[model samples]
Target: MKSRSASKITLTSYDDLLGGVATLEDVREVAIDELHSFTDHPFKVKDDEEMKELVESVKAQGILTALLVRPLKKGGYEIISGHRRKHAAELAGLKQVPVIVREMDKDSAVQAMVDSNLQRENILPSEKAFAYRMKMEAVKHQGVSGANSAKKVGKENKDSARQVYRYIRLTYLMNTLLKAVDENIIKLQIGVELSYLSIIEQEMVEEVHDSTGKYPSLEQAKQLRKHREEKSLTKEVIRLLIIGEPKKKTSITFKQDDIKKYFPPDYDEQKMRSIICQLLEEWSNQNH
Candidate 1:
């Protein structure tokens, strides 16, 4: 890392630092204020265990990858992706972290953040949903403002307004489910399916959070959802199920004496049983 001098850093070319960036090995540390974290990235589910492991690896391997950033209008640079990596670096006592400095406008900055994190092979479903929604919102902000507010590519901004509209639909989910979606436990398609239920049904889904400790299996969620569709369930009922009950399950049983009441007085003991068995065997053979 170079000195804590802004004069040394400049947005020269995106590709030159595309895979390579200046490492601040000489600079032991940079003040946290010089870096601005991106407000747009969506993966916020913190796994403390995983973070601890990340800190350990960073301690051993050093920061193998450089964080992405763009110069802010004010002074510092805003992170695009690699917030977690930055954080882990900090926890590992990194004084200076490698970064790619680029020039981009508001919409492009937001879009770049989403696209960078999302193109990974094992992208989580909830992460996709949230990223899609975030990108849609960013576009909406751009459209509402003006063309100048968005960063220009070669052509006029051509992203479909309707496509952006579809992604924004995800925000309608109740908070519990949205968090579940963010954590990647719930599928985005399943979230869309759940969204079709009434507000009361949505509340019922929310109520179930305490009982399940996680989202229900797709089949179980389907059953609750089916009942909601038939209008046989109300908000109160959904709430009750979601809240759950403490009742114990009981087993069915019958004594031998109680079973005798159904027998006829004319019924034979051994011979009748043998004849019935023969008949049942014949019926089974015929059906096969």
Candidate 2:
């Protein structure tokens, strides 16, 4: 008896394999090199654990979803979404990944890009700052009737429009300060207040921090801004304001070795104390 022959199965696109009808026109696999990131892409494509997991997923199971892209006038495609997926695919050693092409104007593309990435967790403050700014501009360019473009953008993001405007204000901060905001070294509320300062004033604040080893409290930041508006924000003023008045002593202690190192080998405790008092007096006079 002859054995029954097995049926041959031909595999095509993932969409086809799942018994879903392909729209054919929109989705296709394109060379990775042919795709470019959206202009002024606000989101970071980090090589962190999340990206590592994404690469592993693509390597093992393949990209389950297609990227959204739009064709450029000259040639190639610009990624409106899936920037992270595209980076993961590259790391996965795929020569091409699937994408869905859409025709969109600049404003439409900006809105879409922001909307898509905002859903992700772990978004940095810097990313949200620039993204909110871009979206606000795009909303304005679309000729939304009111002056409240931020409000319109907020509606799309499910956030309060005032909150959106506050985020956008962070874009004015210098990169170093902005990074501190991202790291939470500078809290968001204080960062917003600091953002109102001019670049020169902000640099002065940075200088004060470097010299004194202190970051301004929220109250200090507010005072700094007030002085700035008064047009009396000098470096000396910044230093005085940041350091503020001396507070009551909490505790004071000195390491014996540290004190000994600063004095002669035969110096007694009294001698060491005398030298310390002299040095501190000089320091106090110079600071005053």
Candidate 3:
């Protein structure tokens, strides 16, 4: 009889491990502490409702799919994907997870990581920004011919090359402004225009917005970018740009008592305002 030796086994590539006849045997149960996150992972792991649901699922049925990882030179494995899953498993009090080990280069690891995470339905703007930027750099490092890495990434992301560049530009924005982008306080087009400004210029815009409770309109962002190009973007100029002449409000005002009958008793001022704005926007769209 011959004894099988684990030490003599070697994996040539991820495809061979995952696609070959060794698929079932390639997966192993590893201690959760043995896995490390990918360096500079762009996607966020939030404990929001989605994460809560994942944790519940993991607790109820266990992790259905194995995490994809690569063995590190020193020891343990670096996670190429399943960061959120790992986090959820932790919250579910899981000490071990199933993983598939793959031998891959840095570029391959990065491409795999980006491709896997980009399939998520609710990725934030900031996540997309950094992910696109990282994938673009990895594509270049992989010796991809030509300078159109954005086009390659765009094809995978279902966007145009120009749109990919625009999203990547968001990486240049300050943290506060970038947070605003994530919160939808600043639209994508406006965020792209603002990304052209220097860090200090972006800070100036953030300060003005914080102080005045206002955001830059598309026209205002364009003007700000133009001023920045001419090297005339100062605090005062930014202030005026963001706080451009406020249009006069109509003199007519509806008293709370008068409008209260039209709304539900549970409706608050913010909810009423939101409904009004939504109706107005729909009406404007229909008319136009």
Q: For every model in order, what is the number of clashing pairs?
A: 6, 0, 0
Clashing pairs in 2: none
Q: List the residue pairs that clash in candidate 1.
A: 1-23, 1-24, 1-25, 29-95, 207-242, 208-242
Model 3's number of clashes is 0
- Residues 1-288, candidate 3, lDDT per residue (tens digit)? 111222333333345324444354667778899999999999999999999999999898777667789999989999997899899999999988877788988887888888878878989999999998888998999776444888898897798889888889999998999999999999999999999999988888888988999889999999999999999989999888787666888787888898788799999999988998899999999999
Better of 1 and 3 by TM-score: 3
Sort order, lDDT high to low: 3, 2, 1
TM-score of predicted structure 1: 0.55
**lDDT scores in order:** 0.61, 0.83, 0.84
Runs of candidate 3 exceeding 4 Å displacement:
1-22, 245-288
What is the per-residue lDDT of model 1 for residues 61-114, given as tens digits with 9 covering 90 to 100? 766555668878788878886677788888899767767666777776877787
lDDT of 2 by residue, 18-121 (tens): 23443434457788999999999999999999999999998987776677788999899999878998999999999888777778888888887898788788
Q: List candidate 2 stretches off by more than 4 Å.
A: 1-25, 145-147, 246-288
